[model samples]
Target: MKLEALAVYEQPLKWFALGLGVCSTVCVVQGWQLAAMLFSLPFCLIWMYSGWLRTEPQLKYINMLFSVLYVYGIGRYFWLQA
Candidate 1:
């Protein structure tokens, strides 16, 4: 797909992006690099993309599981490194 063909934000996702962006920035600043990276990138991207694409509810549930895993990985990193 072309760069311009990407789905941009609607109301719900626009708000979600704003909140997640701020939280991710805080995590990055506090030395939670893994959390920040996961929250800022893959989690946010997956959430937004799936929402925008109107993916099936079951797939959205799977994405939610991935998000939970992302958070767990961040927690593990903090425990190991911090």
Candidate 2:
């Protein structure tokens, strides 16, 4: 597998998602669920955009499910803690 073939996406959003994913992992391990979800927002958003751009129904639906689950987790852990 050549990296050149897989490097078709020439956008800053992918990099943004990567950075956020790393930070989100750190936040999760630190017990900062709210922050983790917040960080993951950009990553999920990018996937949603690319998923549609790629015309991939499966990718789009999976990303949609992940987005919903992420939001639900945030609400359940952060909002309901009160």
Candidate 3:
């Protein structure tokens, strides 16, 4: 798809991903099953890939920052178990 189209779709996907990440965090904090850990992957993918499609420089930078932070938090969640 075109970058513009991707950028358009990115908003809803980002929201969904954020929701999933929040759910994953809740599950993790509550001592839930490890299966919930997998949910963060999709969140990270959507956030990072969507950031790549952003055309506006300012928005792209913001996206990159948020995406990196989200991915890092998710990554640390897993690493903390090790």
Which is the leading candidate under TM-score?
Answer: 2
Q: Which stretches of candidate 3 lie over 4 Å from their true place?
A: 2-4, 55-82
Clashing pairs in 3: none
Better of 1 and 3 by lDDT: 3
Q: Model 2, range 1-82, lDDT digits (tens) per residue?
A: 6433444663777887889999999998998878998888668877877777777788778878888888888788866788
28 Cα displacement, candidate 1 (Å): 1.1
Q: Write down the TM-score of every candidate.
A: 0.43, 0.75, 0.55
Please report, as a residue range, the 10-residue window in candidate 1 with the lowest summed lDDT. Answer: 2-11
Any runs in candidate 1 off by more than 4 Å, and if so which?
A: 1-9, 42-82
Each prediction's Cα lDDT score?
0.67, 0.79, 0.68
Task: Give the better candidate number (2 or 3) by TM-score.
Answer: 2
TM-score, prediction 1: 0.43
Give one digit per residue, the lDDT tens place, for model 1 in 1-82: 8322555544466577778778888997898777676766565565646654675577567666767777777678778977
Candidate order by lDDT, decreasing, is: 2, 3, 1
Whole-structure CA lDDT of model 3: 0.68
